[model samples]
Target: MNNKLISIALTGLLASTSISSAFGTNISIVGRIQAEYSGINIEGFSSQTTVNDPTFFSSWGIRAFEDLGNGFRVVTMIDFGFNTNGGSIGNREVFVGISKDSLGTLKFGRTHSPFADFAGGWTIDPFVYTTLQATGSGGTMIASANGLGSGSYSAVNSVVRFTSTTFNGFSFAVLLMPGDADKLEAHLGGHLGGHGNNIGDTGGENGEWDVQFAAKYVMDFQSHKLEVFGGYSRDNVSSAQKKITAFNLKTEEVGRIGGVWSYKNFSLQGQYDFISKALGAATCSDAAALGAIGDVSTRQCNTAMNPGGDGSIWYAGGQYRLGNATLIAQGGMTDANKTDVFASRKSKSFTVGGLYHMSKRTNLFGGYQHVDVIDKNSIVDRDRNTWTVGMRHLF
Candidate 1:
């Protein structure tokens, strides 16, 4: 009887140890690669250029999770971006979070905003070639004004966020950041109904804070699907002599509303943005205390401010599967408010692409995109195009 009791106790101890080891931890790695060719055309210029190169690269990520049990977990992910064109590694994302099935998830670090989730769902091009790329948020106008050679505004860094899991196909998310907390208590000031700019008047600090929120719903009925996403973002800038001298503007709010619908193999998506104190309007002189053409204009500045001078974008795309191959086509347009220096700039692009599946884990692809820009003022005219051929593998 004594031997049997000892044997049972040992079995129970071993079982408990195995369960603890199995439930306590997990890890994973993820990645992607891409390649492309690009070309550019400027209005009134006689050059149609070509950028043919082995561009785009594979990016990898390391992710881990710890199970706290009782419906709770701790998670972390780190991503490294590699340049196939330049042969280098880039740090992309680093974040940590605590998650509970019932309570939701809270994360801190650099991550894509809820706004990206709402705005990115409308296209068939994972690369956004034929449609406005996620980085094209400011589009051509802001790109030109800022002298940003390759115009794209896809992500923001240094954020704290909370996300709620899907509840009946509905969910919500919010992101926040502390602007120049050490210099001025602007977050507290905004909470107390004090003007954000006033908190740092007379050169206190010049950093800015951004807040964004989004809500989404996705419903499926057999072969048909519907998705609706909307978001708002506000950015407050501290008052400094540089800001006052550059744009005569201090703070801004930008809001977006959009949705997508799909049936069988076709989909359509649209989005509109209202910007307050538009950033495009602020202009700087090329040379001070002398006569020279400034980089941007005041008209562009005022247009950036007018709420009526908002921007709207729309796109429609379709895909048809043909025995291990899929043919894809998409077109999109962006209309900017005339009052916006960047608003008067308009663009339209179309693409035809295809994907060939080599197996469940590998694929080959190619696509062509043509883009045109319409300029209100002849001072700047930009027309660009690109072609991309790439392969992807998954494990």
Candidate 2:
């Protein structure tokens, strides 16, 4: 069948199957489109500004719930990524699950991990603001090992996820990914390029297993909201016989604590994170091994550079509502231990933005941001500034 026909058939099947059931089912379609223009200037460097490409700029989601007898239900959500500029499909999320008011929900498929969901709540001004752009430490840390990417803490492939229903304003979620441990060894050889000859010469199949877990709690009291979350992930690689292992198995743990206070039309919020060490194989062998001669050769070769280290991050922001318009401003920074190879970078950023409610499901927004980076190691000049203006529509 043609692509269009296939899509039509699948959608029809979903509708028919859902409607034919004894339980009543409801389906809702929703999504958003955001178009933005941004200008950036790095201190000591030239400045550039341009409109953002709308690819994946606009997306849609379909969520359906079947209400079974006695408070039981089946729920499924599929979100499609699309470009606003060209209107094309991007990546997509598909999942199926069973939910019960007292028992919670259990889902199996590709979905967001607990860690990613928690970060979305803790990170101030996410998707709505322009100043905060750090990718690492924000969400799922496990996906970084594989070429496969994750948003905050989302994971693809195969997963079993569980989310508990709120009990007195408190809830929790967990996700598990089951896979072969030997995959880690495969990456060591392919990416690091070694054959298990020396400590630095180990190649493919450095057997290792990957696992991640996260838990979170939220409480709402009158005018304030509190959230506490923690996440742990490990990637362990076993060295081949006769190979020198420079680093032991690697593990990372992340924790976050935050709160939000609201009064009248204004809200204030803050969050902090503590991260443990990260480990990875070296990129380059001895300088000489690459055909360089003399003192360069004497320099350390094939040495692993693990950027992981202890670090903390925090940010605070406030928003005030005025009729159809809302104003927002926030600032945050991250600090890492000097053991990190990527120099300890500190950022101070603030954003001033206003949102205009076009309608119940649509809004127009424009914002400006200023960011300054303080580099301790002189890795690069210590400054970056960004200015952005954007609009969003929801359905």
- Global lDDT of each model? 0.45, 0.46
Model 1: residues >4 Å from true position, as ranges?
A: 1-24, 37-57, 118-125, 129-154, 181-208, 238-246, 280-310, 338-343
Q: What shift in Å separates residue 79 of candidate 2 from its native position after superposition?
A: 1.6
Model 2: lowest-lDDT 10 consecutive positions? 1-10
In candidate 2, position 290 carries an lDDT of 15
Lowest lDDT block of 10, candidate 1? 283-292
TM-score of 2: 0.68
- Looking at candidate 2, what is the lDDT of residue 356? 70
Q: State the lDDT of candidate 2 residue by residue for 1-395, as single tens digits.
A: 01111122122112212233344668776565566676656565567665642213355777788887798889887776554456554334578999999979888766644543443331434332122222221111122322121222123435677888877666666655554434323233322222222111211233333444555566667766565555554433334312434433244445555666666677777666555553432221221121111122111112222344455556677777787777777766656455623445454566666667776545566666555555565555335555666665554
Native-to-model Cα distance after best TM-score fit, residue 107 in candidate 2, in Å: 1.8
